[model samples]
Target chain A: TQLLEQSPQFLSIQEGENLTVYCNSSSVFSSLQWYRQEPGEGPVLLVTVVTGGEVKKLKRLTFQFGDARKDSSLHITAAQTGDTGLYLCAGERAGGFKTIFGAGTRLFVKA
Target chain B: SAVISQKPSRDICQRGTSLTIQCQVDSQVTMMFWYRQQPGQSLTLIATANQGSEATYESGFVIDKFPISRPNLTFSTLTVSNMSPEDSSIYLCSVHGGQGNTGELFFGEGSRLTVL
Candidate 1:
């Protein structure tokens, strides 16, 4: 079974601070996606990175996929209180039939 | 964008009782997914529901404990049988539908179950 590991499982930061979260794995994935979820709700799609070394920006969030397709990262610039949520990374295998998810990083941006 | 809705947003049931959660999507989707999230944990795929086909469950899950049904392309149901305290968790329904069928997955609000 393939697994994705997320680092810094818990993060607490003040508003306007910058934070970065990492997702790594030994298995190579054909595509990777990032999602943010709040309490009592389902995850919301942030972005999907399909190419190695590719970067996608969504407002203040910047996401990058590793060149080897074994890792990914999400960087938030000038974080706001609204950014406080659980961030998850999911990867799709080459066959597109299976997918694995990371443990997720919980960000607490204080106002 | 596909809007997925799940019924019984929150419920408290006895340990031996069973609960069935319903998922409805705004649009017809080819793939419907069910996931479970333990308290303070990540999401785990329970099974994949395909229209007119038996659900494919993951390694740790079984058809007896979690039976899934997909009556059509836009609707599915999951039933948790003989529930225990360990079965208490948030059940979420998701779909693989987006612009041009991208890899992105959309999720429902989720059903929170408490087995006491």
Candidate 2:
């Protein structure tokens, strides 16, 4: 089975603090995606990183893909209360449409 | 953007009972996905709902416990049978990819169920 492991399962920081989450795997992926989910709601897509070494920025969040397509990371700059959520990373296999997800990183940004 | 909605946004059910959740997508989508999230956990894929075809379930899941249906491209339903306390979770429906069909996926608000 292909597994994606997320580090630092829990994080809490005051407003304006910075944090980074990592997702690593032993298998290569055709594409990788990041999502943030709030309480009582489904996950919302943050970014999709397909190519190795690719990076995408959305407001205060920056997502990066590993050079080997086996890992990804999400960095939050000047975190806020609105950034408090569970961050997830999912990867799609090359020859199939099936996807695998990491355990997750729960971030709490207190104001 | 393809907007997806799941019925019974939240429900409290008794043990041994069953509940069927409905998912509706505003636009025609090629792939409709079902996921389950336990408290403080990441989403786990239950199955892939295909139009006019039988749903393909993943390992650790059984067809008898979770029966799925997709009669058309824009609609699908998932039924959980013989509910137990452990069955309580948030069920979400997601559409794979958007316009031009990148690897991105769009999700519904989700159905939250608590089995008492």
Candidate 3:
């Protein structure tokens, strides 16, 4: 049983504040993906990090995969009100048949 | 990227009744998955619907309670039988496109069920 644990289950920050969320797991994964889900909508893929020590950026959002492939992080710089959403981290097994998701961090950025 | 659509976007049903949700994809996909998301919780994989075989359910999930049907490459259905209030949640249909399992999954606007 593989599980990914996420931190800061809830967060509320003023506009222009920066924040970082983390996802850690005891098991190794072949690839990790980040997703953002707003209210009343399914999660949308933000980025995918396939290699250990890999980093991918989408606009002001940055994602990093740990060197051991057991952890990952998402950093938002100068966060805006639009960045408010539930951020989820998912890890895919080597065969890509099984994927496990983290609990997710719900961020609320006030304007 | 594939576009996915789910029918009965939101439904309020009485307890002990059944609800069948339909998922349609614009293009053929290699894999289709069903997930349940409890309020303020993460997505839990319920089962993997194979194109021609019986759906493979994850641990804690059984085929009898949540039966799945995948008749072709682009369509699937999930029926929640004998529902209860605890069963009220968002059900999402996801698909993996591209060749040979190289692509990420695309999700449909989930079907939200509220059992009263």
Candidate 4:
């Protein structure tokens, strides 16, 4: 079974602070995706990284895929109150449609 | 991107009862997925529903406890049978975005069930 382990299960930070969350796995994936879910809503896709060592940026967020495709990271610069939500990392196998998700990182950014 | 809608956005059910959640998508999709999520947690895929075929459940999930029906390309239903307190969770319906296997999913608002 493939599992993605996420670090810092919970985070509380003041506005304008920078934070980073990590997701690691032993199994290699064909692609990795990051999602943000707010209260009472399903997760929304933030970005998808398909290549090893690939990095993608969305406004104040930066996502990185590991060189071995076994891990990923999400970094938020100057996080605002709007950034508070649950962040999840999902991995897709090379030849399958199945997607495995991490435990998720709950971030709370206070204004 | 496809717009998805779920019925019974929130419900309170008694233990031992059953609830069937419905999912409707604006566009026809080849595959539909069902997921369960505990509060403040990540999603766990329950099964994959395909039109004109039986649903494929994950390792820990069984068809008896969660029966799924995909009568067509744009609709599906998931029934949680003999529910218990542990069955209280948010159920989400989702479909792949665009064409091919892009690894991107668009999800519905989700049906939140609370079992007493």
Could you report the DockQ of all the candidates, in the order they appear? 0.81, 0.76, 0.68, 0.83
DockQ comparison, 3 vs 4, better candidate: 4
Candidate 1: which stretches are off by over 4 Å? B99-101
Candidate 1: how many backbone clashes?
Answer: 0
Least lDDT summed over 10 consecutive residues: which range in candidate 2 chain A?
A: A91-100
Candidate 2 off by > 4 Å: none
Q: Write the per-residue lDDT of candidate 1 for residues A28-101, one digit (tens) a residue.
A: 88999999999999999989999999999999999999999999999999999999999999988766666678
lDDT of 4: 0.93
Candidate 4: give the clashing pairs: none
Estimate, for each residue in B22-92, the C-alpha lDDT of model 4 and write its tens digit. 99999999899999998777899999999999999998999999999999999999999999999999999
Q: Can you write out model 1's per-residue Cα lDDT over B1-116, one digit (the tens) per residue?
A: 79999999999999999999999999998889999999999999999999988999998999999999999888999999999999999999999857654667899999999999
Candidate 3: regions farther than 4 A off: B97-103
Q: Is candidate 1 or candidate 2 better by DockQ?
A: 1
State the C-alpha lDDT per candidate.
0.92, 0.90, 0.90, 0.93
Clashes of each: 0, 0, 0, 0
Worst lDDT 10-window in candidate 3 chain A: A91-100
TM-score of chain B of each: 0.96, 0.96, 0.95, 0.97
Q: What is candidate 4's TM-score against the reference?
A: 0.97
